[model samples]
Target: MDESYFFKLKSVAKDRLSPNGEVAFFLGILLYSGALLGICFFAIYYAVDFKKTSELFKGLFIGSGVMIILLIILFCLCVLFEKMVFKIQKIIGVVTVLYTIFIAYFPFFYFFIYLA
Candidate 1:
């Protein structure tokens, strides 16, 4: 009886970690970021009708905000996909390196543009 109890306990302990831990964390981050992005989108969307209401303003307000939010979401999705599978990771890895290079090179490009 004791052996069976121990075995049962061992089996129970073995699976303590939820199988979906990574997915859970990913979703949590997605939900939080989505809320944040939604708010920023709303703020910019409203800015259209709220234009005369605020002193500081930028045209294409919604466009810029949406683009930024999308980029952020894409980055997050890419990371999640990378974590979920190595095949996807290789693709995301390439994309990530390209993105990093593009971002890194932009300063030089800007400097050149400024110099020119």
Candidate 2:
């Protein structure tokens, strides 16, 4: 028999107009690093009160370390191309900053709640 027109392949063009989310990724990096630096500063400042705030600083350190690890993992994923960058990256960074801030002041929250 004869195969006149069976199947055909079409060439696909690259999408040049769409955003690559580099801005989001850079913003995430900025926010993550800034928060981490702030945590370090607070931990250092509270080191003088070793008796009362040691546990608080310890928790902050641990939380910051975990956050750093997670951000590193995200960086690696971005490098691997397995996941494309998006606004969620910036949201993650913002959430990390907020979460760390909340954790750092947890003891104060307890104190304020107890007072009020």
Candidate 3:
């Protein structure tokens, strides 16, 4: 009885995680990844300009806001593409999620490479 109960709970958890994972993966790829890349670029600009710290923070804030809007637009495009072009939402969604993960983490992976 106890083992069966635990198995049922585990299955339910997995079922719930699937949809949640889709959203989590989407936001992680779109928003957080874009913010990190934007911040890196902004830091380089700051280093070159020697501008006010406040300006840097302001730019970062504005850039993040812009990225959020762009993220929404891109997400809508993905949905529209799946609906109109592919007609296989899960396949396209999974592909986009995987690509986003690659885009988000590729820089970190590349950083570990050493020249021969």
Candidate 4:
């Protein structure tokens, strides 16, 4: 069986470039941390209504906090497993990409459904 072109390119890059996996991993950690924090802030901001509290907003606030804590735990584990830097980077990258898609999709979806 023959390897795909992308596989060949990646192999060549990995061998010759000696990519800084740790840097990638740390960058991903930073991004995920920032995103979680932002979401937490937004959720809490929306939920802060003593007179009228929405169950959905309260749930979002709690969920965001939990996610942030979980990410912190994962960050600690990534720091401990420094040798598995590439795997950590890939995990974070995939997560960030998915989150980005969701972030982008919601607003456009609302706009299309309500405005258009």
Which candidate leads the pack in TM-score? 4
lDDT tens digits, residue span 1-116, model 4? 45698898888788644425444544565575566456545543555432254555446446545654665666667667766656566776665565455444534432332222
lDDT by residue (tens digit), candidate 1, 61-95? 34434544555665566456654533354544454
TM-score of each: 0.31, 0.39, 0.41, 0.45
Candidate 2, 27-48: lDDT as tens digits: 4654756564565546555653
Off by over 4 Å in 3: 1-20, 48-74, 77-87, 100-104, 107-116
User: Clashing residue pairs in candidate 2, if any?
Assistant: none
* CA lDDT of each prediction against the hidden true structure: 0.47, 0.51, 0.55, 0.54
lDDT of 4 at 108: 46
| Per-residue lDDT of 41 in model 3 | 50
lDDT of 2 at 37: 56
lDDT against true structure, model 4: 0.54
Model number with the top lDDT: 3
Ranking by lDDT: 3, 4, 2, 1
Backbone clashes under 3 angstroms, per model: 0, 0, 0, 0
